[model samples]
Target: MSSLSGRTAVAGIGATEFSKKSGRSELRLAAEAVHAALDDAGLSPADVDGMVTYTQDANQEIAVAREVGIGDLSFFSRVHYGGGAACGTVLHAAMAVATGVAGTVVCYRAFNERSGRRFGQPDARLGGEPSSQGLEMSWHVPYGLMTPAAWVAMFARRYMHAYGATSEDFGRVAVAMRRHAATNPAAWFHGRPITLEEHQASRWIVEPLHLLDCCQESDGAVALVVTSAERARDLRRSPAVIRAAAQGSGAGQMMMTSYYRDDMTGLPEMGVVGRRLWEQAGLGPSDVQAAILYDHFTPFVLTQLEELGFCGRGEARDYVAGGGIEIDGRLPVNPHGGQLGEAYIHGMNGIAEAVRQIRGTSVNQVRDVRNVLVTAGTGVPTSGLVLSAG
Candidate 1:
């Protein structure tokens, strides 16, 4: 295991209500979540010495700290690549705490994506800017590959062709996520589980991708408190020990438009992250009692399972068939409903779910959850974490 492994722990997690419209400012949402996390950890904002968040988040670290009444910060950082930065924020926080650079760090993400700037909508400005990111999108925007669904659809189609998988295979993932969500009162889709047939009949967002296959555009915020493992053991909640945390960017990476890769059938970047996570934790797939794999899109979930070696390549279809990913199955997944059933706080909520499972407080808690695997976004430079009971 790496020197950083088990040195830090997630002692607290907090979130605003998941909703389609959270009528508050993004900054307010951030403050609320951060304050809630500190409260959950039995710490005050004055105790926070560091902060981390996504680059895409509108709330600045200093601004959030000021609003939350936090004092001088010794460390502050932001990660890029949209949802891919979810676990990366925690990774940054863990490193800071492990190295004694900071005593307590609050990692947060807050956005009114649904009520404010919806990421699902295509904007021509993406290709009009002179920045490096605009240059990357220029090649695809002109070809009508605009929205996130469009970008993922191209890869999903290729994956289907390579593996002879059907759309129903993807729908099964949606069904399972919704089923789990139905039981979670905090989920937006609570009490709304759907059948595979319902998924097939859902309107199409893009060819080879149903509306149900895509995650919800949610308005919410989530935050986590990271402190040294020793200190965490003294906190209010059971520490979710940071077993491993890693980020990876594969060759030929081009954001979501990574079609140039020779094989579009898998997420090699996630594979890189997976290998590092297991190595750092000195654990394998069998050690993971549950998984909160990112569900921005259903197709990517299958690729992530394969990338992490839970199954052979192109075998996720059969692996997820029946109730394999349910709470009673071999590997329960997204028991908190995931982005599909829960709100999409850019994979932050998924990490919260992992923590809940480790603490044995999850609504869909699995039995003997010694280790829980949580992954960030796919089809991009992604990150992952292996959280264990402390």
Candidate 2:
């Protein structure tokens, strides 16, 4: 087992309300989330000695500390990539805690994705930069392949041709996620369940991807507090032990689109992370009671299942059919409605849902959820986690 396994646990999770417009600055949102997470952990700002966030986040770590009343921090770090860095943030925190670099660590991400800098629209920011990622993206942006949906659609089309998967199959995933979100009052889609027909009727953003298939352009912030397993267990509230956490970049990896790979049908990066997570946790697919697979796009949800060993290489099309991913299905996924139905605060909110499943506090709680799998963004260098009961 990895030394990080069972060494650190998530003692608290907090988030600003998932919304279309928060009307607050991203820094304020981060401060609110950080303070709330500390409160949930029964910890004060003075106790935090480390902080982690996405490099894309507008708020600086020291600024967040000043706003949230956090004192001097001995460790601070940032992960690169867009939503792909979700679980990687926790991985960094676990490493810090396990190595005695920090006693208490907070991982947070805050953004006004809808109200400010909508990622769905084609923006010149990436190609305008001097970095290699920008140079790589410059080639595709000129060919009308700029938005994330367009980038993912190239792979989705190939996946269909290779695996015989249909748009209906993808719609089933959308329906299930919205169904779960309908029941979750905290969800943006609360009481707004959609039928598979509704999914089909939604306008197409790109061929093989309906407007409904894409995750929301939400505005929100989420934060989690990580501490030693010993301290977490002693806290008043139950903790979600970090059974395993991993980050991986697959062969021929690129920032958002890696379509040039010989075989672009699968998420090999997720496969790399999945193998490490299971080996670290000493568990496999069958051992997991539920999952919070990233649902940035409905098709990638199917691809993740295949890469993560939930099914055969080309068998996810069959595996996800027949209510296979619902609450009572073989592997209940995204019990909190995921990024599709819930607000997309990157993937941090999904990690929080996994913690809730472990604590038996989720409104869509799974039965005997001793272990829950949570994955970050796909189609890029990504991360995953195996969370177990305290």
Candidate 3:
């Protein structure tokens, strides 16, 4: 476990233009992002010996490798779950490079989510498969918990009821993310910051969940290059060392609908990952100057802060209330705008932003960022990483 830490680092980060519609194939989006990352790393396609991506990614490893004109591959892997697989892709790639399984592994995720299949729209097919996912979906999808928003709303409403949090509290997160996005040229919401009043005025997707609470159904891609930290130090860009990476499935977990838990106030899966991350990195929440928390929905951001030990349980509402997550605050979160203000290529984009922060080149750069905490989707079996400057 210790061998994985500081052994591998992200040498490059790249992404396609985030938009509602990319007007291209998912494969093309992936290829473009991969090519860009490899170029940023000063590496050629032939140098890539490993590849990792989400299982949900339509652009398979072999397919994208061929498109990029890569030769043989020593490693190829895919992680399960939707957005939860984001950081796992990098974790798998890092494992490959650290253990001498492969060198120069590329991790990517791409999709035409808006123009093609919108995940927000409920489809019965989600519960029809004969696997564990299907079995889990059967428990919630049949009870009007169909879409991602609905699955989240179940726990969200519970969270609100438990913690006395209001819609306004969630709106603050949206406002903050958009505020950061306004200056980020690559953000889908760039130059269009929103107000809390606008967030409260938005239509309801579910009870207690306004439209503003949801993340974008974006059409884009993100790619990262991972290699030995020693090698990355000599690459085109400064390396963001992989201090720690972890994945967790919580007690009584059922995808996004973990309703059976005795207390639904915090994200146990995230806590599991958070503990492992701190132990592996030899650091704690206070060490991170910036964070890229998965903001698929705003409420989970609060819960994650608690679970990650950034704040005490049920103290996140106050923790974020005083602009604690701003660029100059205690922990500047989602400087790339997150899934809410930035485009959601799942959480791949968040990981890319963490790398940039470590390189001291983010659009909303934090001051003297020594360690950056990046989290994948919450509520479900999730993943996270602790990145440091190399």
Best candidate according to lDDT: 1
Task: State the lDDT at 181 in candidate 2.
Answer: 97
By lDDT: ranked, best first: 1, 2, 3
Q: Give the per-residue lDDT of model 1 (tens digit) for 141-239.
A: 998889999999999999999999999999989999999999999999999999999999999999999999999999999999999999999999999
Q: Across residues 110-149, which tens digit of lDDT does each residue of candidate 3 receive?
A: 9999998998998979889879889888877787779888
TM-score of each: 0.99, 0.99, 0.98
Clashing pairs in 1: none
Q: TM-score of model 2 relative to the true fold? A: 0.99
CA lDDT, every model vs. true structure: 0.95, 0.93, 0.90
| After superposition, candidate 2 runs with Cα above 4 Å error | none
Root-mean-square deviation per candidate: 0.9, 1.0, 1.0
Clashing pairs in 3: none
Candidate 1, residue 81: Cα displacement in angstroms equals 0.4
Residue-by-residue lDDT tens digits, candidate 2, 1-390: 346798999999999999999999999999999988999999999999999999889999999999998989999999988888999999999999999999999999999999998989988676888689878998898787899998999899999999889999999999999999999998999999999999999998989799999999899999999999999998856989999999999888997789888998999999999999999999999999999999999999999999999999779878889999999899999999999999889999999999999999999999999999999999989999999997
